[model samples]
Target: MVQKVVIIGAGPAGLLLAHYLLRRCNYNIDIYERRRDPRLTDISSDRTFPISLQKRGRKAIQAIAGLEEAIAAQSVFCEGTILYGKKGKLRQIPRQNPVLTIDRNRLVSILLKHLNETSSPNQVKVHFNCECTAVDGTAKTVTLHPKEGDSFTADYDLLVGADGARSQVREYLAHNAGFTCSQNYVPDAYKSVFLSRLNPSAGVELEPNKIHVYNLNNQARMLMVPQPGDQLHGVIIFGAENNPLEGLSTKEEVHTFCQEKFPIFGQLMSLEEAEALLKRPVARVLTVRCDRFHEGDSMLLIGDAAHAVSPSIGQGCNSSLEDVLILGQLLEQYGDDWDQVLPKFSEQRVPDAHALRELSDYTFPRQKFLVVEFFLRTMVKRLFHRWFPDWVKPFVFDLVLDTDLPYSQVLSLSQGWINKVKRSST
Candidate 1:
């Protein structure tokens, strides 16, 4: 029997899930996204940022044949990070493994392209500019609002909510089912920033294979990564209450502000970018935590919808992709029987998701003193762990980035540091 699988939100998780299910050859997949097709849109018009994929996320992409290579072609492989301090002072932290960084929209385009080229129209269909407004578990149907037409309902043998943090399916489960959920806005907000990697006349060029970072104080910071076209893309992150760009009324003021505060990037920024920066809206991250990810045998949530965390540690997408990977594994184990897969997935993943929230929230300290300790600990741990192999585990950041250790284990090993940071925040 062919199951009709309806996936909401054609982001990484949904599209990737389609790829996995299509391999089963017994499921017809339909993905509905609230936004327009990224492949057909102007990349610059989209308010998106770069995503850094390390081991966990990359392993998931590797499972789908040729997908990793497609993504790698459009990505920049970064070996280390350069941190800029006041007066051009800097620090470099090199990584043992290079990180693959790609713009979020570009990643989506590649995934969508692969889906379209490999799957027949009858096997898979993607509907953009359509939003999932409601779900009826008993009726096995979902209500969708299309951009150009009246709202309609469609039936599904299985429904997966990869709709992101503000998911209507998750909302329905919380209200109609017994799912427990909590949501809070992180204290930080950010604006997408774009700049050329090189400024020839100024003789300023950031390393093409490195991630660039600058801190204008604890309240404001910028993290940029190189893209394929000599482009540097990142975000200017600030405390919600302390947006440095708030008082700048004109593009010239914006330019002056960047020049004074972040001179290296300021030299690379164009007047047009400054004007666009002035007009760009501030974006706040909303973190979601749910007790479990599945409501019943046929309804499930993954990715940001299930466990959205702060991108502070750069595991948001990594973990989301890993969720799809794990689901694929469970389906294999349970012979594609969702009745057995959904509950087991929740039972296995909920703890890791909760632990990941802790790691993501408190891994990076806010206090200046702790920040120093953080770098010191990270450096010492890496060195000592290399020498003493079994004696010292790498610090939280290293363990998270450099290994595929389950997030729960990583949290357990670094509980002391997590506790210290948590206390300092209070």
Candidate 2:
């Protein structure tokens, strides 16, 4: 008996879940996305940002044969990150393992492409421009509204909410199934930015294999990752209460502001991009925390819908992909019986998710003094760990980027640092 599985949101997690379920050959899949098909959209006009995938996320992609190579072909392998300070002062944090960075949409596209090529229409179907408005867990039905048609209902044997932070399925569970959840907007907002990696006329070129970060202050910063075609893509992040770009009224004003505050990137930005920056709406990140990820045997949530966190430590997507990987492992252990897999997944993952939230929120301090101390500590730990491998583990950043240690274990080992940063934040 092939169980029908309905997955909401055709993002990376949902599409990747389809790939995993297809391999099982005991489930037929349907994925509905609220946005237009990314493969048919203009890449330049996208408001999405690049995602850095380290070992945890990469390992999940590696599970699907050939998927990692296909994604790597479109990605840039970054050796380290360069942080720019005032007056062209900079600091470099090199990594032992190169991070694979790719645009979010591009990653989804690759996942979707592989899913389509491997599974026939009978095995899988993806519906775009369809929004999930409601869910009926008792009846195993979901209500979806299409962009061009009337609302409709579909039935599923198993329902997965990978619809992101604003998931309707999760909302339904909270309202109807006694699921405990909390949501809060992070204190920062951001605007997507794109620029050429090189400005030959000005003799200014960012390293093609390094992530570039420029901090104007505690209130404003930019982190750019190199993409194929000599393109640099990222976001200009600012505190919600203090948006630096608020006063800029015109494209020329925006351009001047960038030149004055972020000169190197200012040299790379075109007037057209400046205009786009002015017109682009500010995006705020909403973090979600739920006590558990599954409501019943047939209903489950994953990725951003289950445990959305600040991208401070850059684990948002990595953790989301890791969720799918863990779920796959559970299914294998339980022999694809969701009745056994769902509860075990929640029991196992909820604590790690909570720990990840703590790590993501406090690992990077906001205070200037703590920022200095943070870097020094990170450097000291990296060096000492080399000499005393058993006594000193790498810093939280290195541990996350370099290893696949359970997030809970990582949080436990770094609790003191996390506590100090948390206190400083207060």
Candidate 3:
């Protein structure tokens, strides 16, 4: 009998894995998403919160789409970051290997388009606006509720949960399937502001070639990434519990808080503009990590479902894509042997998962503080780039950006390299 594979969430991980699995395996696959069909509308109305698609994300897209030329056509190539330091010091920190930036909607549209074209379109059908409410891992069944109707049940040979943090699938597995998990909601809250073009001909407010950052100690950190067209999207992150504006009862209080916390921001924006955003509630960022990614044979989790890291490092999406890639490769290598493959997938990925979590935790507080260590590390990294080849930078970059490297091997190699540095320093 042919196996039935039901994947929850039509996000990057689920869609990419589906594309590969459908190509390699003959399983009957179906995808369910909580948002409405994006293809039906040109505008991305359902995506309130935006995501930035970096180079690794682009690589994953190219790998799944089977044509680098097609993917490249849709990308906005970014060299690196433009840092705005204290005393008005503006620095250009180039990545030894630059990455491209693609608009989130366009990337999702491309993935969906590719998935729609091959084999049975309905084989990987997306049930939109249908939220997965519950899962019975023991019975190999899932329950979902649509906007307009009653709850429905679907049975499958394998259930891949990519439903994101606060996942109902994870909850189901923990509650019913005896899976262990842990979730951490970092004390930081963030707000995004749109910097519209002054004039259509003015182009972007910031350079299209790099992400702009105003790293203002633990008080706050401001980042602006160029969106498609002339708009630049800015996000401001601050401590939630210690927020001075948390209990701002009136508009006047909000204005005072904004000016005090982000003076440069206040100088750039009109009081009305600042107040408009302050009137709205702030959004909290949470990081979720599970002790175990899978249990027995019936269920597994990936992406934010298994590990949701803070977006500070910008590795969350790339890491998720890597998870799908690694799992797909393993499944192909160990075909039809679920018993062997499942355990190995978990084992192979565990170290990477831990590494990603550590990186995520590292970035949040350091980026928050605008730490001297961060500045020193950045300077050292630049010097290292000048002295070494492409291979050298990716080694350090992999540790900072790609957490898919084995933790023990990474430690051993890093120590070996560092001892040479210690010898040289002496």
Among these predictions, the greatest lDDT belongs to 1
Whole-model lDDT per candidate: 0.94, 0.93, 0.67
lDDT of 2 at 222: 91
What TM-scores do the predictions have?
Answer: 0.98, 0.98, 0.82
Q: List, residue by residue over 129-243, the lDDT tens digit for candidate 2.
A: 9999989888889999999989999999999999998889899999999999999999999999999999999999899999999998667999899999999999999999898
How high a TM-score does candidate 3 get? 0.82
RMSD of each: 0.9, 1.0, 4.9
The weakest ten consecutive residues by lDDT in model 2 span: 41-50
Clashes of each: 0, 0, 0
What lDDT tens digits, residue by residue, belong to model 3 across residues 1-74?
A: 56788899887788777887787757788888887777676532333334555455555556654544555566
Off by over 4 Å in 3: 39-56, 66-72, 85-87, 103-106, 197-205, 242-281, 363-370, 385-398, 402-404, 407-426
Stretch of 10 with least lDDT, candidate 1? 39-48
- Misplaced by over 4 Å in model 2 are none
